[model samples]
Target: MKITSVIARQLLDTKTRPLVEVEIRTDTGHVGLGAAPTGSSVGVHEAFVLRDGNPAEYDGLSVHHAVASVTDHIAPALVGAELDLRVLDQKMIDLDGTSDKSKLGSNAIYSTSIALLRASAAAAGVPTYTYVADLMGLPPVSTVPVPSFNMINGGRYGDLTQPFNEFLVMPYKAESIEQAVEKSVKVFKVLDQLLTEKIGHKPQVASSYGYAAPSADPREVLQILAEAVDRAGCSDIMAFALDCASSEMYDKTAHTYELNGRRVSSAELIDYTRQLSEEFPLVFVEDLLDEDDWDGYTQAVAEIPKTIILGDDLIVTNRERLERAVELSAVDGFILKPNQVGTISEALDCYSYGQDRGLLAIPSGRSGGVIDDVVMDLSVGLGVPFQKNGAPRSGERIEKLNFLLRVADSVPHCSMADVSALVKA
Candidate 1:
């Protein structure tokens, strides 16, 4: 089928959510819908074209806009040309047409590619995952694990720094959910104290409805989480993980420091990490070191217990960088975010690479916007044990949750994995 026209829309759900919706129509009248919601980067939509008379200027292009512009520009060229989307995506990346090497790009191209894949799958009368697995020579899967949720601490708190909204979550146990939230209040209060002591103002702290643990004082944090899990009514937490994006930041001498435990220092950062994982039921730690501290990251990974050390910012999504990370043994898990890399195929490649290394390849959505339900399909199709979307509240977070629920209901033998159990296992 040849392309007929492409229409796009910019929708804002609230101050925290902004999405670019694109509809591609074929000459054969087959219509496919795709979108990339950039919650943190709203300017990307403006950099793209409107259905009006004149298109917007290129100067308006953000990373997201650059992504969408590819669809606006390249979709027409491929029209009437019999081509496979996988190959087309490869060509786009090969030509660096939307690589965003300059760091000014969008995930719009990724959305466009997903739209084409959706259209191709519909035309073939197969599931999206089947098509991807068939093309990539990966096993097809029916079920995947869900993130316990980071937005809602048993519906007790919200993200205080960025947007203000409540999160919905399935608590650890009805009782622990309350306790965990109560602990969160204390933890954030402590964090606020630390921040106030350092930055002269309390850093607004957000609580995850279900998943509540910060990078500071991992042993104590895990205990608090375990208590929350028990209070929530789960048999056991199964596993504990740490989101350590600030790992490198704490050790930097130039940056301001605080008293995490007798004053946070470089040695203290690594020491605390090791202590927490060894003392508590820690399973994974993401971005343990700064993105650039490969040497420190390698050393830290080696010294820590055999927990899954994951990388998001550190590995970014470039194949070369990923290959380097693997060579250095920098991590044990990979967090796959399409926007981080900018294409589904690229993300899949990262997932596959991690899988080959016996590492968990997790595909994640974003903190904002609910585009289409392609990510849910991709995770199951690829057999990822865990996924990192957001809390089970609001449109951006609920889109993935609803997609999984619908899929589980329709597809027999498919259901949300006991996320906690899967993590520990």
Candidate 2:
């Protein structure tokens, strides 16, 4: 069947920012819905996210132009095209000749592309995840991944001015997503309690992810979270990770990165991260260096060879950038942010590239995600997957976890991911 029409509209995410939500109607009247997620800590190399610049409307972040572009340019062109992955995405790339998808906006492109995938699956009477797997030559997506819950956020996510961006925990030995969630929530609750006791105020919510606490010392925050792991009785299943997002805090003029009121050189940052890995059950350290710091990434990877040195902005989910990372011997893993690159095929290709090299493929959610749980499904389709979809908060973040839990409940014999393989003994 052909794609009959694509309807797009400007909408608000849970963060009250303007977002684009899309609905694709096929010739058979099958419909699919999708939303493009954005982030507070954006990578410079990422594809464009167009917005209106007028201050009066939507605080200069309006997506009305993008919505218009999708309706006026994108929809009419793809209306009669055959419904499939390659054709639609290729036509989109052809329409927007820029390498980084600036002309048409990555938000517009991703929302429409995602809508096509969902609508195609609905038209074929198959689950979206199953359809994605079949298209990618993957087996049925029966593996229920352990969810990496970002229980604490900082450096633009909330009022907390911590150096690192995200502090998350997941259950490593849980038998299923349900069990993983159960174990993680216990840690989150205990962490919340500890933060309240430490500061005489409850940890405030940070966006769609975890609780936010005021602490200058990253190790202290980890210590509190570790205690929560102990108090929850979830040490058997629980493990922690960090998203440094150091690019934001790096002072290029000063040639040092900001860290808890101190200037940290790249070497110093690497050493600090190395210490954290040695001291805690930190399986992943993402974006530890500035995006363009290949030497820094190589040093960190060399020093902490066991933990997953995931490249978020370092690679920006682009295969060419990933190749550059390989050439530099920078990272052993990469974070998959779908909007960063702009298509399902490209995202799958990024995962395949990592899989070919036996690198860690950690799919993650954006800072201001919408309600769709497609990321959770995409991660599960990768088999024994790991994902960062935010904490078990109400709204869009929990929607993703709920989707995983349903996947586990609906599918029989789904097992926990073997994350130990990616970590030091």
Every model's Cα RMSD, please?
Answer: 7.5, 1.7
Candidate 2 ranges with C-alpha deviation above 4 Å: 156-160
**Runs with alpha carbons beyond 4 Å of true place in candidate 1:** 13-17, 39-72, 94-104, 151-220, 235-237, 247-267, 371-373, 415-425
Clashes counted in candidate 2 amount to 1
lDDT (tens digit, per residue) of candidate 2 on 21-103: 88998889899888888888899999899999989997899999889879998999898988886788888988989999989
TM-score of each: 0.73, 0.96
When summed lDDT is taken over every stretch of 10 residues in candidate 1, the lowest stretch is 160-169
What is the C-alpha lDDT profile of model 1 across 1-425, one tens digit per residue? 66666655555423333455557667666666676644332212122222222225223422344434555555555566553676766755654443352222344555666777776766666877777767677755566454445432221123312111222122222122233334333433343344355445643344332333233333444455455444444423334555555532343555322334334544456666777666665556666655666676677777775466777667765566678888998777766666566666777777777777777776665555464657776876776666665644456555666565555566667644544542432
The lDDT values for all models are 0.53, 0.83
Best by lDDT: 2
